[model samples]
Target: MYEASDLKKGIKIELEGEPYIITDFEFSKPGKGQAIYRVRMKNLLTGYSIDKSYRSNDKFQPANVSNLKLQYSYFDGTNYVFMDPETFENYSVNADLMEDKKDYLMENMEVDGTLYNEMVIDVTLPSFVEMKVMRSDPGVKGDTATNATKPATMETGLEIKVPLFVNEGDVIRIDTRTGEYLARVSTK
Candidate 1:
């Protein structure tokens, strides 16, 4: 259980039998009223967000959430599969839950899997990943005079802008959060 005073960003709590992670939190003491806690939370199961307020005396149940290190297995036509490296247990997550993240997934990649009530709820990839450019247009001479970029398709099929010097077959580091090219990595 958690007191309203314990509410803060990143804290997980249970409400109405569902788990929620606090995304934002603020405290206020009205001129004539008791202290209130304003919280914005995201439902772990549904990915829905809500804003609610509570008094300092309010209490909340702690959410049951766990993190596991899993390795990317393969994507069946319908679902993405992950495996626990130690136990060799397999878990499947729906495509809808992957969304844009599907673009960054690579076979054998290690990621953090968030579990709620023993069910996989979410997966977190590494902050950066290196991928080979499958296709890219050659940069024109003198294009380097300014900060120029060209579109490159990664082996995963994710398209990103790379510096003018980048070419097809080159490996590049990408920032997963922003979907931006970080730097070119030598294949050697």
Candidate 2:
């Protein structure tokens, strides 16, 4: 249990049987009336945002949330498996929760995973990942135009644009957030 005055950004609480994390918060007093707590929160289960105002007497239930550093194991069709490096325990996340993130995950890579009420909810991958270009067409001769790029297929099946100079069997760094090419890391 927490009092309204205790609310702060990054705090997790339960509302209507769902867990929410406060993304922004502010405390205000009207000089005469009671204090109010304003908060902007995101629903952990549905990824929705909402705003609410609470009176000084309002109380809240603290949500049970935990984070772990887990290593990628494999996708088991219905769920993505991750292993606790120190304990050797496995946690499975629903495949739907991994949608776009699967492209950036590599075998045995370490990632931060968030669990709410013991249910896996969120995963954070590295900012940059090194991926191998499995196949890419040769750059056109004399096509020296600035910022020129060609299509490429990565080992994970993520299609991205790489500099014309890049070719098959080359390892490149990718910015996971934007899914953009950073630079060629190596050539095989």
In candidate 1, the residue pairs with backbone N, CA or C atoms under 3 Å apart (3 or more residues apart, or in different chains) clash, namely: none
Model 2 clash pairs are none
Instruction: In angstroms, give how far residue 50 of model 1 lies from its true place.
Output: 2.0
> Where does candidate 2 stray beyond 4 Å?
none
lDDT digits (tens) for residues 1-188 of candidate 2: 99988989999999999999999999988888888899999999999999999997799999998899999999988999999899998999998889989987889999999988777899989899999999999999999998999999999999999999998999999999999999989999
Instruction: Please identify model 1 stretches exceeding 4 Å from their true place.
Output: 27-35
List TM-scores for all candidates, in order: 0.88, 0.96
Which of the numbered candidates is closest to the native, going by highest TM-score? Answer: 2
Q: Which ten residues in a row have the lowest lDDT in candidate 1?
A: 141-150
Q: Give each model's whole-structure lDDT.
A: 0.93, 0.92
1-188 per-residue lDDT for model 1 (tens digits): 89999989999999999999999999999899899899999999988999999999899999999899999999999999999999999999999989989999999999999988878899999999999999999898876566788888999999999988888888999999999999989743
- What's model 2's overall lDDT? 0.92
